[model samples]
Target: MKKIILSLIVFGATISLASAQILPAFQIGLKAGTNLSSLNSTASETFSGSNRAGYLVGVWTRFGAVGFNFQPEMYLTSKNVDVTSSSGGVTRAKFTSIDVPLLFGGKFGALGLGGRFYTGPVVSFAIDKNQSFDSAAGKVFSLNYQDQNFAWQFGTGLDIKRISVDLRYEAGITKQTYDGRQTRISLFNLSLAYSLVKL
Candidate 1:
């Protein structure tokens, strides 16, 4: 925890020093959104849909030009899965992760339209995991789910002045479960952000 804070401090200092001489093409923002998440695996299951509420708060920096930019962010995400059985109603499985993403974007502006296409990598660390099931006999299964993995993201956004709205899709490139099972997590996120400070 201390190390993470120190690293962020160092990163902020580095960015500050680097922007001192440049044209000051940097901005910071906060983001919040929902996540449509699920696991793609070979395990036998009877689940139909799994959508959950997730949010993120972080600072972002954008370099010059509407053509290319790099944005890095840190956020806390909540992911949940809903399962149903033949005789039962529904079950819920929830997981939380701390994620850091580094993204690159391309922007286009014309005809009163402005938007950007962005894609990048994300690293996540799981904080909690649990499952609940509703069955004929109220059957339940619980396992210590691991959620440390690297993920790839692709998305687009609209940028207007100090505010931006983005939609992104994320797919895990590495497995998260500890049982050597081929399981992957994916997220569809919508975020709104405001520029905290501009340089």
Candidate 2:
């Protein structure tokens, strides 16, 4: 009887301690941001990439304890870039996709203000009407965009009450083929998020 009572007490204490550590079990928020996107050639024909402004709007959710959490987000985004070659060939690209990112990160600080850092895999499914674009005149190179883009994102953020700001860098892990040449994409993202529900 005493052993059973002790076990019950221990279990209750553990639960209480865990609950105490978790300020809120979950949070849902809306975030909107702009990104500067660029592309790089990974083939024998070297080309320079130029950045263009792209935008994203999404909803995100975070769960687990405050110190460490899992964050997942879904967003509609545009990634655009311009490429220029030494021979004065210019190509412009606009890609729109639905993106989902699964991120794991941690937070530190106290008194309702903290800093966060996260790294994750973000997958993008293209929704653009056109998947391929014409090459510049006299230039055999062209962009053949894939239906799915796989990338990684890592960044840091600051939280003040219900509003947070994040700055992140994203790089493609897959290639977007251009004729016989291949290219990669990269972006820098800045976003503002507001928590609609925090519990």
Best by TM-score: 2
lDDT of 1 by residue, 111-152 (tens): 325688888999888887767766654443333356677899
Instruction: Note the Cα lDDT for every prediction shown.
Output: 0.71, 0.83
Candidate 2 C-alpha lDDT tens digits along 79-147:
988766545566677889999999999887666688899999999999992333335543534567788
| lDDT, residue 123, model 1 | 87
The lDDT leader among the candidates is 2
Q: What are the models' TM-scores?
A: 0.72, 0.82
Q: Model 2 TM-score?
A: 0.82
